[model samples]
Target: MLKIEEIQEIIKLIDKSSINEFIYETNGTSVTVKKSADEYTIQQPAAVTAPPVIQQIEKPAEPVVQEQAPQIAAAEPATSTKKTVDYDYEIVSPMVGTLYHASSPDSDPFVQIGTKVSSNTTVCIVEAMKLFNEIEAEVDGEIVEILAEDGELVEFGQPLFRVKK
Candidate 1:
């Protein structure tokens, strides 16, 4: 567990620093951090000619919440309690294609933080062969995480959600 003082220091550093990416590894855990501009565009590595999915080049005013260190400590021994690894469900891609967060360039994303999603919800779009396909959920659960960026090309079975059962 991270100390409160350390968590505060990390938040301060994140606010004061502008190095869009940061990584820290300690105690067998690795944390990767990124702060993108509103456009939230990601650069494709050289030698990879595929275009990036996210094309927004302008900055958006998303609130910044550097981690504050989990308040609750880890669980006790496994025998003390059943592990909560039983996820309610996961949304996975059906094909290898580019994922899009919105229907169009100037439209709102299909989903956002705290968005309640039901089974068959259209969470995002995946474009293949110049055709846009709506990717829907296969199970009912609150979205706990969006594993891929907007316009990211996801492979078959790639994780798209970390849902609470």
Candidate 2:
């Protein structure tokens, strides 16, 4: 088993290096470190009884390809005199993590469609590395649309809700 200091050292080394993933196993102990975007995940398993098996299979030769004829473009439609443009404000995620609509499983969501919110109102929670981060609406408006579903994995700067001021 690796000590806490050793694990921390391994994590630091992995973060500094260019490699994205590192797996080490010895004496029935296994440690796996993986990097996703700008974050690093470290997982230490209790034990490993056997080494992983990797098998390579040969691929068959590529078949002959045939080119298809190009299609003609369609006629353009007539332009309208008036155009309506949307000016909705998007609430984006601050970090890459799993999005939660509510604080707990049985609790109600912080905000929903048509819910009025201020600049500091909590709208959702983003869980990253076991830390729950409350996400707030940065503009004073009403939620017009929910872009992401509950318990979905969201990327940094991804829009979670659309609000109309």
Candidate 3:
């Protein structure tokens, strides 16, 4: 079971972060915290036993208007600006750590959009357990987009960049 101060800290972190919900489990205890606009809610089991799994709705409901179907179809091009890339190579993080786009704060980023990189290019750095390890782009290609945020914590095998040969 988590202490009251720990739970409050987690709630504060969730409020500051963009994450909608946080769930933690240990041994047989489980806790879930969700943030909605200005309200914060925390849920936990009464005893020390684990709680049942809960499915959540990830997205909000979109407004549907049958009569405006044609108008919506005509206005799609303006609202939908995202392009779909069918084939691309992803530069993935090799370890779980904090990702840094540059060696230092004022320094230029290692790679950017449209930057051409070889197989041995150092694209970024991941600091794990106080050690900063330079990450390489294993594929030779031009960087199309950066997927991970600079200085954010990244999970192992998380895609950092999208590249096209």
Tell me the spans in candidate 2 whose CA falls farther than 4 Å from its real position.
1-87
Instruction: Residues 41-104, candidate 3: write the lDDT tens digits.
Output: 5665544565545433343443323321111111122456778764369999999999999999
Q: What lDDT is obtained when candidate 1 is compared to the true structure?
A: 0.62
lDDT of each: 0.62, 0.75, 0.75
Residue pairs with backbone atoms closer than 3 Å in model 3 (clashes): none
CA displacement after TM-score superposition, residue 68 of candidate 3 (Å): 27
lDDT of 1 by residue, 1-165 (tens): 344456445435554555454444444444333444321111212233333222212225456655333221222123557344445677888888999989998999888755788887899998888888898876677777778998786888898876775
The TM-score values for the models, in the order shown, are: 0.48, 0.51, 0.54
Pick by lDDT: 1 or 2, better one: 2
lDDT of 2 at 75: 21
Q: Best to worst by TM-score, what's the order?
A: 3, 2, 1
lDDT of 3: 0.75
If both were scored by TM-score, which would come out higher, candidate 2 or candidate 3?
3
The Cα error of candidate 3 at residue 32, in Å, is: 9.0
Error of 1 at 61 (Å): 52
TM for candidate 1 is 0.48
**Residues forming the 10-long window of minimal summed lDDT in candidate 2:** 67-76
